[model samples]
Target: MNCDLNIYCDESTHLPNDNQPFMVLGAIVCPVNKTSEANSRLRELRIKHGLPAYFEIKWNKISPAKVDFYLDVVDYFFDDDDLEFRTVVAGKEFLDHDHFDQTHDDWYYKMMFLLIRNVVPSPGQAFIYLDKKDTRGGEKVRKLHEVIANSIYDFDRRSIRRLQIVESHHVALLQLSDLLLGGVNYANRGLNSSSAKRRVLNRMQERAGITLTKSTLLSETKFNIFCWQPRGNRP
Candidate 1:
């Protein structure tokens, strides 16, 4: 484990009964040394847009008023060579947890593993950070660390170094993850309510060169996505 990487993870519409049709798990992968640079550049972009340096970028906040700023953010992400995004989009309608004898949380952790497995490099170390969602944040972190470490056979916890919860508002990379994840979830749900959101999604599709509703090749590294299906579900 010579090189180091940082993974900022986030999710959208993951609740069991949130009336949403899809759940999205997303992450931003950056080399440990490039984290600071990326954060600084994002802040600079905020200032360039006449917003405060501490302004938190979020998907829900996207509107016609600030569409250009958000568009610039999308362009910055695709232009940067040091940053990469990956997500797992799963339809909740296809879920049958009882048939598999697994709780929703168990399935979520399993998806977390699948989401990061392709990005975790061999002969390197990774530190994971998930957005703070609720009071069970600590428990989720512990379970996620255990599952990821065990799946990688990192009993000694050397390769998978640290897993913790962080506030998305305070972490630029985590905020970026939320924005990208929200866009993917919005696309998969086949909704076109907001023109601003539609523009953002269109920009992502143009840059990634794949329909947001479909899965990309496993080897695609820059803007990778996996559309997960249940055991008996058809594509």
Candidate 2:
């Protein structure tokens, strides 16, 4: 009965007409077993880096400066081995003002899928946490969760043991990570008439050599479109 715990956090921005790129950022963290040498190493590394006491390293307060210190600690301990932590930042550009009529669900799903694929967790027990997109008991948030769940379930049944989605405003760690990785995305946005949306599309094509089709663009817009679905009995 080995308990392996993993957590995932993501952030998304949906703005129309604004040149600012819509971005999603995600991060994964795994806690090594307490008895293992990894735990001891983590503690030692924290001490070496002169970071705040272990208990004080909460997620909400982690800024770029803190991340720098933490990564220094991580490098000290796990530099030799291939550590599993990862951060993903995805950006989508908006060209047409009319495109807002479409939805962003597909892009969200695709980004999550990409993140999951990179993490490649084992079949052991795992817990997933998502920053809540909807508050005030909104129906749209409920429907988005269902779509996300169905997509993941379709990809791998029983891939995760439990999933918890809560408001990002309440989760300090998710908020910190989102701010850090999302900053990079914002910096990459196009200037003036140029936009991150266009750059994202171009980068995708150049890296993957997959040209964006009119249908794909329309579909992505459709996915981004707003919709409210009630979270009745679906889990």
Candidate 3:
């Protein structure tokens, strides 16, 4: 990717039929200059935990045995000055596909745009990677990519260029995004059953000094969040 910034995107509880109260779209923004360093460091952190080079990280995999390792990863995210996390979460309470004049599929990309729009610097190139989770496969992924580029008026392909659906297992940074999104989703959804999960949530809360369930300052670069209201639907 001929870009200066790499964004690893992921979402939690974002299915159309899921009973979850919220759908969160999150991205881990890393500077291109540090992309290799970030991935190398994350893989090294995995090795420190005895995880193999091919190990894939995910939120559902959080367990008591590996809680400490997960905690360290969370800390590493904040400790690393080059990494940033941001998300756009939407409440499903007033979700009306018809009212929004779009299908859930369309809304998914719209949320993706919202998640990245505020962070992508103008007059620069960036590559966006989303977890390969779309139901309609490659075509949908391609369309979302074009939609993002078009939204930014990058019709000439000079600014934001690449958008691809990648398997999270192969991309360590993508997995990090997933873990971060999962933590926020768990807390905001009031899931208190998993102690390991709660511990991560507590750590995140301590780091931000705010409810993991609420939005942080818009200028908060380290851990930023935006809560999308029910009536707020894109054109």
Candidate 4:
């Protein structure tokens, strides 16, 4: 089975006790054949902005000095039709894990499923790469693979070919995922600490034609957002 698509995923402020009220999980979906070209353009963008080729595009690293470059990167993503993004944002302040009979990790896996469930096309195949978070992340990766594969009934694992953890710096697309996910996280958190970050987020909002804080139509292919609302009574 040929995996025609590649999905690079990243998460921001997802820790259960990170003191952050919101968490964002996101993925960059790109055609396998266009991956090389996409990376090439990103590299070019970096060089064009006087950044080293090896410099990673990280949202946290954005500053007034580099705002223009980051804004261009945002535009590049939207200009390229082959690139698409989808994210799941959750407000974690009121989660009742005990009442739900599940751990935070379990809910995390469910969020992962929500992020990609609708992005996978019918009769299409994809390989998922997640940014490595910690030492135990390998185990989480395996479990997430199981959750997704089972959800789609891909018992043979053909439709969802593989799921693995990768270092963000090693994968250009993963870094891009981090930037895009960061914007959603920042917007949802209602932060204004960084003018540079706000500038970048404004560019993204303008290009996508939607406020990042709210959920976009699921059918919105270019920049899809799902604001997950937790249900059920608390214990």
Candidate 5:
């Protein structure tokens, strides 16, 4: 069997009119055989924190009371050798849907490609999990799956086996994506309302040895950041 990669994806401030400075798409990648171990480790984190077995890990739920628990989760991600994350941040300041002759939806799919560039191994199949973001229909999601598969030149769509919408609460790795992506979005936008959130950001800086305020090096493997800006304008 081809050893596949499982990618748990989540996004922050994705709405076209949300008025946020950046739209962040982040993913957690793990080898096929290691998925269960990753899930178990995250579940253990919840138990370590006294959270209920059913507790749903989330970025927006971080607070003073739960800050330490969240920090430990962050640390686990950094310490785990089998896990990896990458993010692409697109600024909305000078974006024009009309200029690209694309609907906001179309632009989103394109950005998704950039977010995973070089992250997917072509020789191995990839399974992508996205948080349930819309109920309009499944057709959009289906189209996105096709687009990605095609971009990878997987015309038969075999290399990329699946791209499905899932509830974040049930998926530990997806929730991790939410937390890490939230910290990136918060730090980039200069929002520091929570000390715990700031702590995660600072910790990431200390580990990555790069400021989170800008794009990371193209070759950064553990936590890669890609900043997307308008061609003629400063981001």
Candidate 6:
């Protein structure tokens, strides 16, 4: 396993009773080799777009002109020819309307499974950065990691090997990435119910020309959202 491959995971939500899809979990995995370049590009983008360094931009704050600028930044940085990003969206239905359930856990686990399966990283180090959640701290993450390890063990059919799940609150780069993804989520939300929007799904198929499998309920659920793989690295 090589010491590379950092997976940045984040979720987006529209909030209560809006009838619009509110939550999305996106993972942007890049090779360690490109981290520096990505960061540099992000810094340049921040300057070019005049967005605050640590602040998150919401739809209401962005006018049409600013939206154009923001999209340009996405095209500039995310359109890179050397990196790949995998996004997972968990809509309100997946979570049972914000309440946790076995079904929800199954959906969450399946999403994680799909994300990792898509990456298919070789025997190398993998870093998973999850956005803070209620069960994200202390025993919860630990248990979640345990569940992931067990799942990996079953998937690999061998003893669990290498993987790291870390909780981070102060990583500015990740925060910026989260904001960028949020913007994408926001822009993509179209005529779907206010509780959930299918824009991202539509955009991904439209832009990337990648069709998701319908056999899987998750894929079907995400059909309305856009999902993309970053340009360069595998998995």
lDDT of 1 by residue, 178-203 (tens): 99998999889998999999999899
Per-model TM-score, in order, reads 0.97, 0.48, 0.92, 0.96, 0.94, 0.61
Least accurate 10 contiguous residues by lDDT in model 1: 226-235
Residue-by-residue lDDT tens digits, candidate 6, 9-69: 6666624354655345556666778777877776666667776553343323444446554
Sequence-dependent TM-score of model 6: 0.61
The residue-by-residue lDDT of candidate 3 on 73-180, one tens digit each, is 888888998899998888876788997689887887788888988777665678888888766668866787788878878888677767778888889899999988
Clash pairs, candidate 3, are none
Q: Is candidate 2 or candidate 4 better by lDDT?
A: 4
Q: For candidate 5, lDDT tens digit of each residue in 140-189?
A: 67878878888878889788787889988888888889988988888888
Off by over 4 Å in 4: 1-3, 233-235
Cα lDDT computed for each candidate against the true fold: 0.91, 0.43, 0.83, 0.90, 0.83, 0.50
Candidate 4 has its poorest 10 consecutive residues by lDDT at 226-235
TM-score of model 3 relative to the true fold?
Answer: 0.92
The true-versus-predicted C-alpha distance at residue 85 of model 2, in Å, is 3.5
**Local distance difference test, candidate 1:** 0.91
Candidate 2 vs candidate 5, TM-score winner: 5
Q: Considering summed lDDT, which 10 consecutive residues are worst modelled in model 2?
A: 221-230
Q: Rank the candidates by lDDT, best first.
A: 1, 4, 5, 3, 6, 2
lDDT (Cα, tens digit) per residue for candidate 2, span 84-199: 33343444542322344434555555556555443435545555677665553345444444555565563453555556676655543444345433433443443223243334
Q: Clash pairs of candidate 1?
A: none
Q: How accurate is candidate 5 locally (lDDT)?
A: 0.83
Q: In candidate 6, where is summed lDDT lowest over 10 consecutive residues?
A: 213-222
Candidate 6 local lDDT, residue 65: 48
The root-mean-square deviation over C-alpha atoms between each candidate and the true structure, in angstroms, is 1.6, 10.9, 2.9, 1.8, 2.0, 8.7
Error of 6 at 155 (Å): 11
